[model samples]
Target chain A: MSSINSSGEPAAVRVVGGWASPFVNRVVVALKLKGVVHEMLQETVGKKSELLLRSNPVHKKIPVLLHHGKPIAESLIIVEYIDEVWASNGAPAILPRDPHGRAVERFWAQYIDDKIPPGIRVLRGSVAQDKDKAAGEMSTALQHLEEAFVECSQGKQYFGGDNIGYLDIALGSFLGWIKAVEKIAGVELLNEAKVPNLAAWADRFCAHPAVVDVVPDADRLVEFTVQHAALLRAVNVPK
Target chain B: MSSINSSGEPAAVRVVGGWASPFVNRVVVALKLKGVVHEMLQETVGKKSELLLRSNPVHKKIPVLLHHGKPIAESLIIVEYIDEVWASNGAPAILPRDPHGRAVERFWAQYIDDKIPPGIRVLRGSVAQDKDKAAGEMSTALQHLEEAFVECSQGKQYFGGDNIGYLDIALGSFLGWIKAVEKIAGVELLNEAKVPNLAAWADRFCAHPAVVDVVPDADRLVEFTVQHAALLRAVNVPK
Candidate 1:
């Protein structure tokens, strides 16, 4: 392998993604957390790139991490792959070292996956009333997560204990979309009053060096969401 | 494993689950594959045991494997935990040896998890037409999975090559559920003609020692589904 590049990318490693996708952001934060420099290939939204299709033939979704031309797909799956491949490269483990600890982190990560996406789908629903209902549901979810963070963090700054980790990346990657949802729906989420601790944690997570740069711009995500929804309506693609 | 029980379980390991949950079967098969004899605690449907609630407070779901009094939840995640904890005990790996191989297997496992559950949900729908629609979708999914088997199995007997691996357990756990769905919906799934290879694989998978006993009886599962649906309607429980 060649030397690391200025962008902190490792030679021969590449990520196929879209700029506004939180799923793609997951890969970026993972690479950055590992201090690895990898080339990024931005694919257009709603249109699959030949590289992405070839890389992830099964799902044909983005956030495919290619190492030495062999591709791995699924955002969290790619993050776990990165952790394994680079475990010996002096990077801290993305998952916890102990099996039970790892299992705990994985459980929370899966919880985030299960909870967040459905709320986002409702946020993207056609009716403003539905968005409000979704926002309320997401608020309750955040309160539970605040309790979870307290249990998992052990008074540390982050879920990985003073650093970003699997669960942090799992939830934090949605910072931009969360923002866009609040703006478009005009409803508060990650409710500071109800989930004050988690709301604070969200701030620290987004401001962390690993996440600050890679997260999609909130305004851009808002515009993209609005345009994409209109385009979906125009084309009448089945949801 | 306390000299290995005739039932094939490990000591100090307990599986809190239901008789008919495909998710629970995944744990049983994985444990049996490793020749571990874990205790079983069967929880009634529509009821939560104190142990299950305490072990998995967040989701309050079943299939929690308690090892040495510590709990791990989620079926596949528990499987991975089992693989890691028992890695040095001479059992073949449930996941692959290499990271890329592991990633590939993980991808397919995620695909199976994504594709199977929704079909089951639709199978439980109030209307027969919705079940038919779901069966059609699932049949198409099986066709794709058949293609995946060709790519993954490489003429071997199973997805993990010589034995069942992550993807195998992921989909294989649902064999009985597929049967129940077929019986209840009155339509073919895992369409033998369309996905002949996967169809054959299912027969061999069900007959395997690790799976044969653990999979819930098909007739029992159908009965459970009908009863559970009726119970929900009686109680006016939210879907």
Candidate 2:
């Protein structure tokens, strides 16, 4: 943790996050890369802790990184804040120096944030006849995602080439949920046959030391999904 | 106007944008500020122009600024790109230079971006008996917003203080839309009696030379809303 100042103030980054949240994982990976130390508080979402409630009064969502009492909500925003505050030496810059490169990265990150949620909607919609429609939408979204990776990466190992960047973090959060949806729906969105580059990128990302250490256990995630998938499906089914 | 590059190419930053989009207006303001010369192309949303479709196939959204043949999409991302590329000597930096100041600015900007749309939901839920319910939600949102602005500006004239930064530009594009909604909805969200600082801030932002020059014409916007409000109302009406 070279980022810590000599005064031993702990560099003051406390993440109010949940255990199963992939969004929280993105922030965790970023903090780890920055060599910053902080307490990680696992929040109960439906019954938000009083501290979480006070820290993020507006959204009341998890992954709120409270730095010295001021909370920064939204996982991506917190990641950027970590990068700015820690000023890591020789660590991967989450954004590119080239203006164009930065835009491309942010563009994909925003797209994933906005559009990929529809796939989650569809995944939740599975098990009803309406599930079929949601499944179709998910398929289309995955196809578009495949095309995006093919175009953006060209031949690079990551969105930023050789090393993962913001887009990688943004997109990587989906892998666990996506895999769970694939199992629940009996379909595969990230078939290597269709999106080899994205699949490879996912592999490289999962292998990264920072990512490997922080990601929630895959077997536990799968078991949890298997338990909860039924209720989620029932709720999303049109009455 | 001081940002003419050494290439002597009509300062040739190219913009792929659409009319009638607030996101595109963000880029337009930044370019006008730096006096950067740019070639503009209007690209459609559902059916993009060949150039845009090819250049920004990943997101397939407009407001992609091309500099030296590279494309940058998403509005905020483009704003940052423009700021980085065209920032002249002694001109106000769109983003704050101090890490803490930057973090605070970004926090509110993200807050506004995430939460303000729901505040405008009053415009949507007007016809139903639950219209009052929607208005209540709007009021709560506004109250939160009042606190946010107080915290954001404190004694400063702008989020960046005295100088219009990214937060101002980001919020400015929406002020016209908010005013338009207020008129049709017959409710004032930013009444001076309630949100005096924010109301004054909005007034100052609209009067800023860069903002005044680049914002869409009020009359045209009013006319556009008159024709479109009916369609919006129909979309939001309860079944």
Candidate 3:
């Protein structure tokens, strides 16, 4: 785990997020990594607060970071905001310094953001979600990420090298969801045999101090998935 | 116009792009704004180049920027890359200087990136595209952008305020396709009467020298769309 550089002002930073959300976890863990003390405003699913709606008028989604008076929505964007606001607050840098390195981070973060949970949603999703295609995409994306791990990690501890950086926080936040999905799907995405490095990386990432509390417990997620699937089955009558 | 601080060497910059792509237009225009001359390696729709396949193996898509032999894929990410590498090169900044302002730029640029063409795609799309939902979303999103234009522009000419910034390049690149889709669908998405400010902004944005050569001609796009639609109609027979 990277040591905290400077203790940020706790009162100044706040996150409107749900406890179970991997998206929300990205913002939260990023803040913690920066040593920024923040308050979490728990948001319930299916109901958006005035703060969220105003903060993100377009999507009205959770994980809106309210710094001082302004609201920044979207998890990855919010994490980038945290990195910039505290660029020098001295906790290890979230983004790399060089332009190319930064762009590479953005690319992979985007890849994870766009592909995932959507990629794994099929395990818990209704019949309409297309399990075959989602499974195929997940399989391919995992292989790519496995190769990316070899390249980005460079035999270091994390995507950020010796410490956690942007891609780490980006994909690390989803570890619980991935685990739950794997359990539900009866598949090994980050398999020890197939993606040994990624599987090992997931273990190291989850054990990090910055991550432990932010990411939901995999077992809890599994329970939630089962219940959610049951509820969906009840609600979704055959067309 | 933001004067170029340095004439970045043309030899170092090469773009793998297709002529008719709005995504490609964004990267091209951003480089132009930076006063960086570049070579365009044209790519056909059906065939993927060895260069492209090598550079962006995952999706194998175009609009990959090759700088000093390194590859950067995805248009918005490439534009951000351009902004970062040439940050001091005297181009009007694509992203803003302050963290909050930069976040705002990223938020809206993403809003534009995520919404558009997808929002408007229904107009030029096949049967599966939900016209009503898309049209409704477009109507709402345009209103949001219209309002955002007022806020971001602050009575100035562009989203970047006085000079074209990230959001301007992100959205402006699509004007050609927007016009073509309008011509095909007989709809006014950027309606002057409805969104006077955005409508006016679009006209002004297209006239910018950086944009003129890059964005494909609206009439040409219209011709392409007509041909493409006819081809699709012929191929997809009561599947």
Candidate 4:
């Protein structure tokens, strides 16, 4: 899928990301949506790579898209870059053309970024003392997300209406982890009964060809979650 | 400054913000830079306005830009909207025209958002036990910011090279607060010896005509800080 730029030269695209990271998957899904060919360099947890460190010295985190050897960090920013760069390549529009619609999409994306971690922590907690409270908070967060889906989707299949866009990729990357979280917590956080729109949206998102190709196997994610549950709980313990 | 759209109707612009909020000032500066006319609705901290609540139902936060009765929340997002909406209005460019440059600006803006809060917490801490540690962390954070300015500015007057851009607006909004924070914490965070480039950039940013028009008075900010320090410290105290 390497294409000629305005200079009539082939475009160089590469992504340095972690396999298990939802943030990384966001970039992968976006690239696939744009039909851009790129190499993915997997980064190992607990060990930093020279290229990753060189590319993103400040954050030193994964999901760095190296476009022509220049790195762009932060998953959302990278996704926006992909959308803008590949905009005229006949790829699907990830962001709305109008400023207001784009801003709305960005607002929800940032909300998801801020809200999802706590929900994940709720599911990660193993202690019975915190279970109920955590679950309550997680449920409230999920409900807020459901409301967002309702408002943005507005009787459509996705947030951008009739297609997967920025918000879908941002939140949908968590499909595998949400499944693992539900099983570990033994609570149905998302369902047709609770958040019908979000549940259906998730199903549609997971079934997308691009999403299907990038999302990690559900069983592998579950196994990883079980193995790391104790460590996650230890880290999430109240200070 | 109202202009007719394609429909031949005047644009209605309103800003719901607080006097002492750095986030609010960001929008104010952007509007001033874009030469857009906007009514500024000052929001009382303890009492949010009906307009704010109605516009930003999810976050219910200030610095919401109401354009044609539609509300766009979040400071950075609002700035982007203002820039995009006024792109052809011939105002000075707040963001770079090129995709790569815009992405770099956004990457730093996000960095500023993530790094500045911890520094603010350090300044808000009342106890001496945590002051040194917090100060150390803040200094490290500042150093990282300084590195960014060096890389992005490349000896230019601003992050966008001789012009105040998105990053400048984002980080420059905190200049007054940084002054208050330094006085309250009894440490100079930005100086000639350390982060000289950022210090100079802050001076240039504050001195800009648009920034001068919107920035809260330094004395007023200091007084406000002194008044709110105790309340802020109480909230900042870790559980």
Best by lDDT: 1
Question: For candidate 4 chain A, which ten residues in a row score worst on lDDT?
Answer: A230-239
- Candidate 1 lDDT at A69 equals 83
Is 2 or 4 the stronger prediction by DockQ?
Answer: 4
- TM-score for chain A, candidates 1 onward in order: 0.88, 0.83, 0.88, 0.87
Writing each residue's lDDT as its tens digit, candidate 2 over A1-239 gives 33355796545778887666777888988877666677788764345789888987777677788888777777777777777776657687877767677777777777777766566656644434466666666666667766666666667777756667777788887776676666766677778886777777778888888788676555666676566566535433111
* Top DockQ prediction, candidate number: 1
Give stretches of model 1 more than 4 Å off: A1-11, A124-129, A226-229, A232-239, B1-11, B124-129, B226-229, B232-239
DockQ, cand. 2: 0.59
Interface RMSD, all candidates in order, equals 0.5, 1.6, 0.8, 0.6
lDDT by residue for model 3 (A1-239), tens: 22222664445677888777888888889988888777888875556788888877777777788888588887888888888888887688888888889888899888987787676666656455777677778777877888888888899989889999999998898889888777777766777898888899999999999899878877988876666665544533100
Error of 3 at B48 (Å): 1.9
Q: Of the pair 2 and 3, which is ahead by lDDT? A: 3
lDDT of candidate 2? 0.69
Report model 4's TM-score to 2 decimal places: 0.90
Q: How does candidate 4 score on lDDT?
A: 0.80
lDDT of 3 at B180: 74
Given the true complex, what DockQ would model 4 score? Answer: 0.81
Cα lDDT over the full model 3? 0.80
Q: Poorest 10 consecutive residues of model 1 chain B by lDDT?
A: B230-239
Candidate 3 C-alpha lDDT tens digits along B90-171: 7788888888887887888888777776755566764558776776777678888899889888899998899999889988
lDDT tens per residue, model 4, A1-239: 34445776535888888777888999999999989888788765556689999998887788889998889988999999999999999877999889988999999899888867566656755444466676676667778888888888888999878888999998898777777777777877777788878888988999999899787766777777677667546533110
